[model samples]
Target chain A: MVDLTHTLSPEFPFLPVEGKTFPFRSSPIATIKGDGVYANRWELTEHVGTHLDAPCHFAEGAMAIEAIPLETLFVPLAVVSIAERVATNPDTTLGAGDLMRWEKDHGEIPARAAVFLHTGWDVRTKEPGAFVNMDGAKTMRFPGFSDKAIEFLLGRRSISGIGIDTLSIDPGRDKEYAVHKELFRAGKWAVECVANLSRVPATGAFVFVAPVKVAGASGAPARIVAVW
Target chain B: MVDLTHTLSPEFPFLPVEGKTFPFRSSPIATIKGDGVYANRWELTEHVGTHLDAPCHFAEGAMAIEAIPLETLFVPLAVVSIAERVATNPDTTLGAGDLMRWEKDHGEIPARAAVFLHTGWDVRTKEPGAFVNMDGAKTMRFPGFSDKAIEFLLGRRSISGIGIDTLSIDPGRDKEYAVHKELFRAGKWAVECVANLSRVPATGAFVFVAPVKVAGASGAPARIVAVW
Candidate 1:
């Protein structure tokens, strides 16, 4: 079993929204000394850290996080590595060609599969700013799925969702969020900022993309794992 | 696949704390009208809904939510139903003799299994006040595991955790929480307020008790699932 989730906390940098975002924060709510048990209260934006963006995140009147069928959350895991290219050009993406190449080596992307774009971006998570890769404070640049790749998966394959080791399904500089709209428009979910995509192989593992079962929320921090 | 998680929200009744508990609350942080995408900020206490209680929840220096290994979270599931007894005696417990009867009928309780006490309490979820079954103003009447049953599983059987359909692993009326301390003392976790235990068979299902990967928190809302 491999945990693909980041340890969400206030320290984890956020995809900036007007120079600020509600990062994950924890406060002591109970203690063994007083309440006979230790517990906490948390406040966080639904999209922070390793999380699943429900279709409702962009598609109005779509499935909320709780409405997603449990069977859909359990999918065949497929990792498409663009890490080698990303090492050289930080703006790399998992394109349609990359998916075809993966199929050539493995097999066809299986039905109800979650294809994760592995950009080796997980390494950048050690530093707050590097993970988002904000260049000169103007536009953030990191790897994501190309629009063509998303269309191919939705139109050609039988996948349940797509995931990435970056902040958003669209490239960091994509102000329009083309990929988020495309995927959510199909009523599919997206997993962003996954921690350990490298540890998983190209195919064969069963993945569980589970978010906190928050009723009617856009997204929530998720604990993603793969078991072979 | 069965989702053994309740939809967490403000309307869901919490395990009342004094006059109030920090119930799961969501506020729109972004929207298609304002931020070009829908999103919400959530505030929740760790133990309010379907959740996992880490060993550190009671024991001072035990595992926090993040420290629990992914391998440990995946275990064989065993549902021990006390619903028949609970129909009449709402405070009925799954005791040591119950384990003996279960093993007799279904064979031995396997190693590293999650034995869930199914009290058929999920049907009461339609009315929040009825689910916890607070007896007037005195106690909350609900089924849980006996200390003998917990110790039997801990000392005799090699198990990962114990779970209950009720609000806690110890009966709600037992304010001292004896079962919680006994289980956590041996570094075992607990899954409380699970949604659907009766749906799972007596054995053969693999369980995933996953909580939000909140850094250094005692517990968090969990999305528990079973695949038979």
Candidate 2:
């Protein structure tokens, strides 16, 4: 089993929300010296670090994070590495051809499988600015899935969800976020800011995407893992 | 698959820490009416609702939430139901005899298994006062594991960790918190405030306890599920 989640801390980079930031505050509630127990109180955004985007995140009247089916949370993993393409162009988008190429190498992507786009973006976690990859024009740059790729997965392949190592499943600079719309329209969920995807096998890995069951919340932080 | 997690909300009952409360506030960052997306920002304690207690929660220099071994997070489920006993005495504690009774019915408690103490305390989640069970003297009433039971599990059975449907693995009134100390001394973890244990079978169920993976934090809110 490989942990595909980032250690959520104050330093972890979050998506550039206009009036929001990932606020993580921890203070000791109990200490070993004075009290027998040692514990902490943590306050942070539900979307901080590795997290899941429920269908409701992009589509109204869609399933909230808690409403996501347990069966869908555990599924076969299909990792498609786009590190080579992303190395040269940070804004590269993975299209349907990339999925087809991966399928050609390793059988069909089974229905209800959780497909992960591994762009090797996790290594930049230390450098928050680089990980966000914002340009002079204030547009973020990162690799993500294209509309055609998401459409194929949802319409044809019938995948459970899509996961990516980058911040979002849609390109960082995409103002429309068409990929999110297409995927969420089919009641699909997404796992974002995933870590250690390189260690997981492209096929046959069992992924567990466990999100905090926050009632009526659009999305919540999740602890994702894969085992082959 | 059974969801053993309580739905975290503002109304959910949290452990009473002096001058502390589980503050869960959510506001829509993006609304479908104005923006094309619907998302929210949440702020809450890592120990709120259902959560995992890392070794560092009691032992100094011990494993933090993020450092907990992935192998230890997923394991076989061993549940010992004490609903009847707990009904009569709110402060009832499961001892080695209870574990022996469970083993007698089923097989031995296997090594590296997640032993869960099912007290049916989750039924009171709706009644905050009853769920917390705070008395006139300011001591909370609840069912938990005794030191002997924890010792037996850790030394004899070599179990990975222990879980309970109550707010804490130690009785709420116990200022000493001996169960937590003993368990953490052996580098074992704990899952607290788990719900819906009645759905999970006593044996042959695979339990997945996934925490938020907060860095350097003693504990974190977790999503725990069991598959039979």
Candidate fnat values, all: 0.92, 0.81
Best by DockQ: 1
Interface RMSD, per-candidate values to 1 decimal: 1.5, 1.7
lDDT of residue A82 for candidate 2:
96
Native-referenced TM-scores of chain A, all candidate models: 0.96, 0.96
Chain A (candidate 1) TM-score to true chain A: 0.96
The sequence of per-residue lDDT tens digits that candidate 1 reaches over residues A12-101 is: 878888733656788887787887778888888888989999999888789999998888899999999999999999887788999999
True contacts kept of 2: 0.81
Q: Give the alpha carbon lDDT tens digit for every residue of B109-226 in model 1.
A: 9888888889998778768889878887769988888899988999899998888888888987888889999999999999888988878889999999889898888888899998
Please identify model 2 stretches exceeding 4 Å from their true place: none
lDDT per residue, candidate 2, B1-228, as tens digits?
999999988888888786655555677677888877777767666678898998888898999888889999899999899999898999989989998989999989977899999999999998888889999999999989999998789878978899998889999899888899889889999999999998888899999999988888888889999988
DockQ of every candidate structure: 0.79, 0.72
Q: Which interface RMSD does candidate 1 score? A: 1.5
Report the CA-based lDDT of candidate 2 relative to the real structure: 0.88
Where model 1 places Cα greater than 4 Å from the true spot, the runs are none
TM-score of each: 0.97, 0.97
After best superposition, candidate 2 residue A15: deviation in angstroms? 0.9
